[model samples]
Target: MSLTDTRCKGAKSQEKDYKMSDEKGLYMIVKITGAKWWRFDYSFDGKRKTLSLGTYPDISLKIARERRDEYRRMVATGIDPSANRKASKLVESIEVKDSFKLIALEWLNVKKSEWVSSHYSKIEARLQRDIFPWIGDKSIIEIKPIEILNVLKRIQDRGSLETAHRAKSDISQIFRYAIQTDRAQNNPTIHLGGALKTPKEKHMASIVEPAQVGELLRQIESYEGTFIVRCALQLAPLVFVRPGELRQAQWKDINLETAEWRFKASKTHQDHIVPLSKQAVEILKAIQPYSGHGLYVFPGLRGDDRPMSNNAILSAFRRMGIEKEEMSGHGFRAMARTLLAERLRFPDGIIEHQLAHQVRDVHGRAYNRTSFLNDRKIMMQDWANYLDNLRKGEDVLPDGFTPLHSMQY
Candidate 1:
């Protein structure tokens, strides 16, 4: 007979555990301790087994019979209900542990060792600010391409189109990592290539004309900022190294006797040598008395332990009425690259080498750092002399500033 609600509520436990059968394989067991549980007994592959439907009052007699019928149907179909339940639980657990945020963080930790601190910081910041809040909790394997596109669209909507594209690339890399680690089946970001708007390329602002360049040189010389900053400003145009490398220059890396400044290139992490010009050496010597004993050549005004802020030179340019669109700290590089090649007529190979740019040979092998050291030394001095003449309102190319004619590039 089927168990009734009144009987289930009023029945007392016996001295031993006993059950009131509901129907089919379903029954309510009343234990000696007065606890009641619902169980379903069934056979699969000639073996008998019991499946706990739930507690008596918690799962009711009607629900117990329904579950029993369901499991019986599974057994009739040559499947075990208990095994299927276990498999579902296993999948749930894996999905929880393989969430997008967790897997992306794991990939970042593994890749951080190969990246510079600034590069790592930028990636981490982008993920935390733009990505993690959107789909971080979702399982990587189940995320659809449309869902990823929504995140990129939001970033693009905010006018950070370039950053949105970069975020997409980062997400793609994370998905690839997930695939390699067996946590994901496909990369949703891979299909989002054409979905985002491409960002327009804007060249860095610079003054390339000789007259404008001369005026800029005059303004830099008369810059009434901190003495250390003034010296750095003076040397920036002459050396034309990356602003970060210039500000982070150390005294130990520079040798006035050899007229060279040697340090690792930040972007490539390769050893780079800057052949110091006569003007550059003079500027360095002038600042030696103040920052010679410190770690950074252009230490911050507030403290000698830290390098000058990256914005120092840029801010100085602003104060001098030079808008960012007119000239940036990095603009010195473009200015030199143009004037050196056009007016001075230096070989492109020598100029590129002096710029510490990565150049490959015909075989696609990277050129050595010192590939054109001797030619660069001559070019460096000539460039510095040209700048001195410009500062004095003289010809852009002085008598000794003639380009090497006989040397084949």
Candidate 2:
């Protein structure tokens, strides 16, 4: 007979005794207070072993019989039930493999020290905001080109085509990192080159037309923004260096005695000498009261320690109702370039050298400074005077503006 409650009840009154049921090969051992623990005894590979089956009433006789049958099936299949159960638990606890988010984070961590803090923050923001939500849960190796294209398409749909293009570039870099680590076989982003909408051509530096440039300059002169920025706006076209270089200008870099401003260009990674025009020195002298005490030529509103943001001039342009294509902070360079070459009849080498163009020699490349400094110094003065005339609405002809034929030299 299988275990019956009457049989167990009749015999289990004597506590502290091991009770065996020959009919079912189960041992029902009773503790001193009359609690029953079940044990199953069996022979595996001619060796006898006992497996604990929990306490009685917790694991009922019917449940015990079902568990026994399950073990027997494992034996028939040449599987050890206990070993299989342990392995399954281990597999469940394991994290499977790295997800795209984990891999991307690791990728960022490894390269964090190589990048500036601002660049690090930019990459982190792009990855978290655009890339992570869609592919973070999936493994990096599993991501395909179509999925990446979908992400680009999503950013494009939001009318941020430039951002979409940046996201695509960043994602490609990330996948390339994954490939280097052997986590990914190949870059899926490679196939997605021409799949997305062609990026719209929006000039980073907006330059107004020669005819309208004077009007824009007048608007800048009359702009009623913060005094430091107003002075910066007016000085933009006079110097026409990169926006960062302009804002980060220090008093030490300026030689009022000689009317020359010298600083390192961050983009070209070279020393740049800007021959300050008489007009530029006047503007600087005008703004000296505000920025003279600070480290930067254009200090931020809240502090004297920090330089002004690059957007200060661009925002000023926006307030002047100048579209980005019509005028940007960097567009001043283009304005000076066009007017200097076409209107003022300056040499191409002088203009390019003043602009700090990288010239490749037989050995390598170098930024030539004094290649045409004399003509460039004069050209800068005339350009500054021309801008002043434009701001004053005087009759200034953009007459000497000509395309440079010797850009290669």
Best by lDDT: 1
Instruction: Give Cα-based local distance difference scores for all models.
Output: 0.84, 0.73
C-alpha-based local distance difference test score of model 1: 0.84
Please provide the root mean square deviation of candidate 1 (C-alpha atoms, Å).
15.8
lDDT of 1 by residue, 69-136 (tens): 98887666545666545434433234466677776776676577777566799998998889978888
Candidate with the greatest TM-score versus the true structure:
1
Positional deviation of residue 144's Cα in model 2 after best superposition, in angstroms: 3.4
User: Model 2: per-residue lDDT, tens digit, 16-47?
Assistant: 56665634456677767678778777665455
TM-scores for all candidates: the values are 0.71, 0.61
TM-score of 1: 0.71
Clashing pairs in 2: 206-328, 342-400, 342-401, 342-402, 343-400, 343-401
